[model samples]
Target: MPVVGIIAEYNPLHNGHAHHLEHVRKLAADEGIVCVLSSNFVQRGEPALLSKWARTEMALAAGADLVLELPSAFACSSAEYFASGAVSILNSLGIIDCLSFGSEEGDIDVLKTAADILAFEDDDFREILKSELDKGLSFAVSRQNALKTVLTGKSGQNIEKAAEAIDQPNNILGIEYIKAIKRFNSNIEPVTIMRKGQGYKSLDRTSPFSSATAIRHHIRELPDLRAISNDPFLKSNMPEACLNILIKETESGRHPIFPEYYSDIILHSFRNMPAENIASLPYMEEGLENRLKRAAIESVSVDEMVSKVVTSRYPASRIKRIMFSMLTGMTAEFLDELKSNGYAQYIRVLGFNDTGRSLLSQMRKKASLPIIVKPAGYKKLDTLAKKLFEHEIRSTDAYVLGYRSPGQRIGGQEYTSSPIISVR
Candidate 1:
């Protein structure tokens, strides 16, 4: 059977997500839908509202055939690395016929054109990018300026349109996804579904399809998850099945995992860590580690530390990634090695139904990398793969500390827990 791949956090599956999955089912027809999901920690470098397994169950219930884990190293990195990692995994699967994503700009041609310009940056583009960067503007702003300058006369009005498309959050990720496809030279066709409801960062709950940020914010505002059952806001915004799972996880003391829960550990870790070591983590550059060290010593919370260190050049997201890297012992050298070894070293099964079982069977024979269905598979991996898997283990151990229940905070769940096998 054909397979359509989606890369997402699903942080907690909302109605918008269910809508997207329903569309994918129609678009794929008889094909299986494979979702590459972020782990407990998401792209923003925060612990997911619910554990990965809970999210996996949500995805399976929402129409996904299979769900796979995006390694922690790439899951918490910047857009480029995140997209690259997810796309690489799909490419390695050898059965994905299309890669589908939600974007503010639903036009594939626009995203592809922008992706082409970025994927194959010429000398002129680089020089312009450097000049813009030297002006003290943020990287995102600088790249937009650089692209506008480079595509000035070549594309005419298309330049303005492409530039606008690049400015939106989802469009930026969509472009990166297309760029990664080009980088991998994969055959998977790109498909874009126009995003519905509020913007990615909007916390507005007026709409039925509220943003994940809004949903999470609403959930956090609750005195406890006990209110979730009667919360009309959640009832309208999330699918019944997903909301039920969230409710179950909440009652079990496993819901609403937040970054602040790990603040003390992060602060303690940073205080004990040397500046030189912090400098070695991914995204650390040009004495930023020193600033972070000072922030760690001065601030009482992760939010305060981030506020102190974040700047136009080093945005809050970047700071969080650096902090998370330190907490999980992720280094630039290790990530570089993984990149050199082709981004993904193995396919980690997170959840699957019968359709997914068949897909996994096909992957076992055709996938470029080893297919890992259980922890025992770790021992069979190569050296680099072993190291990467260890990083995931460390990340999970650190992540569980954020759980409300003391019993749920136990480490090594990676070895004990199995993928959610949905019986449908």
Candidate 2:
């Protein structure tokens, strides 16, 4: 069967995600759908609304055949590393024929052109990007300006259209995915599904196709899990299967996790670390560590601390990632080591259906990397792989600290849990 790979967080799979999966099914003729899902920590540098297993259950229930866990390190990093890590894993699978993602700009050619420019930056582009960066602009803005300038001068392309295409969050991620495909020289073809619904960050809840951000916001505002599960807004917005799984998880006190849950621990972590140690964390630069340290000392919550330290050059997303990195003990040295030794070390199965089981059997023989169905399999990995697995274990332990139930907060779930098996 031809396999289509999707990279996503699926924090709480809603109607929009179901629509994407439906299109992928049609595009692939209902062949195997493989999702490289984010771990407990998502790309936004916050704990996922539901556990990875619960989210995997939702995916399998919705339509996915197989779900693999994107290692926490890459799952919580910036778009570039996140896309690179996920794409590398899909390529390693040795079965994927296409990579499907949602984006505002549905034109694959437009996205590909932008991706090519980014993947193979010319001297002029680099110089322009550096000049923009030096002016204290955010990396996203700097790249947009550079891309617009290059596109205008080089190809006489519609500069405004190009800028608009890359401005949307999903479009930006789509470009990164294509860029990673080019970087790896992978055989997987890229496909984009134009996003339908409110904008990525919109909080509107009137439509059935609501943004995940809106769904999460709705869940957070509710008084308790019972109230959330009973909310008619959610019932209208989420697919039935996904909504059921979400309710089940929330009833168990695992859904609706927010960054504020980790405020105390994050502050504790930062308070104990000196400025030098903070400087060692990944994405640290320009003495930002000193400012972060002062923010931690002065602020009472994660939001306050982020507000204190965040500037135009350093967005809140980056600050949250840095703080989570500190909490999870991800360092510059560790990330460098990971990059040197293939971005993703192993394919860790989070959940699978009957179709997925067949795919796994084939993957055992064809995959470039080991397929880890059980946590004990980590014992057989090489040095770098083992280290990466251990880091994920620690990261999961840190993530669970945000759980509402004390029993769920226990460490070592990474080792104790097995992949979720769903029979459809």
Candidate 3:
């Protein structure tokens, strides 16, 4: 059977996600849905509202056939790196025929055109990009502005409104996904499903197809299960099965992890870290670490610390990634190694169903990298792979520190946790 792949955070599986999966299933036409999900931390540089295992169970319940992990290093990265890591894992499986994603444009051809332009980065585009960056625009804004200018016609207007799509968060990520696929020269075809509901950043529930941001806002406000079940808006936006998972996780003290939960730990990590060590962090540059180190010592809370550390050059997400890097002891050397290697060394399975088990069998036959099903197998990996896998473990251990229940803060949970399997 053919395999269709998707890359997602599934932070708390909502109606929009369920809709996407249904579309993937119909588009695949009997092919299996293989999802590469973020673990513990997400691209936004925050702990997932639910743990990876809980989120995996939610995906299986929502009709995904298989779920593999996008390792912590990549999971907590920016869009380009995050997409590259996810697409790399799916490609290494050697069986995925297509990669499907939600897009505001819902036009694969248009996304591909933009992706090719970005992937190639011709001389004219490069000059414009450098000019925008020099103006102190964030990388995302710089790229979008450059593209808008480059695609403009002789009349000084954007051609066919090509630049508008890149302004949306989903379309930006969708373009990156396509660019990553092309960068690897992978054969996986690109597919897009028009996104529904409010934008990704919108916190207001506009319809049953609410954004995850809106769902998360609801989760933060209504901590009681009875209240959550009674809230008509949330109930309509989230699937019943997914809601139960969130409730069970919250009740069990394994969920609703907020960045504030680790404020003390992060502040401590930064204050205690040696000044020289800051130079070794991924994306560290121009004495940025010095500003962060000073901020950590002066600020009393994580929120204050972030506000102090954020600058024109360093966005909030970048600051959070730096905090995570320090918390996990991730070094510049390790990031260099990853860049040189270009992909993960193993496929880490998060969950599966009966059909997924069959897909796993095919992966075993066709995969080019090691497939990790148990913690004991870490010893069999190469040196870099083992080191990278250990980083994931450390990240998870830090993730547990944010747990509301003291008992749930126990470390090494990644080693003991088993893949979430759906009963037939």
Top candidate on lDDT is 1
Over 1-424, each residue of candidate 3 has an lDDT whose tens digit, in order, gives 4579999998778898999998888876666899999988988878888899999989999989999999988888888888999998999999999999999998887787778789889999999999998997778889998998887773422344457788888988899999999999999998998997778888877689878888888777775745765678877988999888877887786677888888898888889888888778876777887898999999988889989978776789888887887777677788768868976779999999888998999999999889999887888999989999999989999999989889999999888988888975
Model 2 residue 204 CA deviation (Å) reads 1.0
lDDT of the candidates, in the order given = 0.90, 0.89, 0.86
Worst 10 residues of 1 by lDDT: 151-160
Pick the winner on TM-score between candidates 2 and 3. 2
Give the runs in model 2 whose Cα sits over 4 Å from its true position: 154-160
- Clash total of candidate 1: 0
TM-score of each: 0.98, 0.98, 0.95
* Deviation from native of the Cα of residue 74 in model 2, angstroms: 0.4
Could you say which candidate leads in TM-score? 1
Return the candidate ranking by TM-score, descending: 1, 2, 3
How would you encode candidate 1's per-residue C-alpha lDDT over 1-424 as one tens digit per residue? 4579999999889988898999899977666999999987889978888888999999999999999999899999989999999999999998999998899988898888889899999999999999998987778889988987877777556566787898899999999999999999999999999998899999998999999999999988888679999999999999999999988998998667889898999998888897888889998788888899889999999999999998888889989998888888899999999889889999999999998998899998899999899888999999999999999999999898888989988999989989999998
Error of 1 at 295 (Å): 0.9
Report the alpha-carbon TM-score of model 1 versus the true structure. 0.98
RMSD of model 1, in Å?
1.1
Clashing pairs in 3: 280-332
State residue 371's C-alpha deviation in candidate 2, in Å.
0.9
Q: Give per-residue lDDT, candidate 2, residue 226.
A: 85
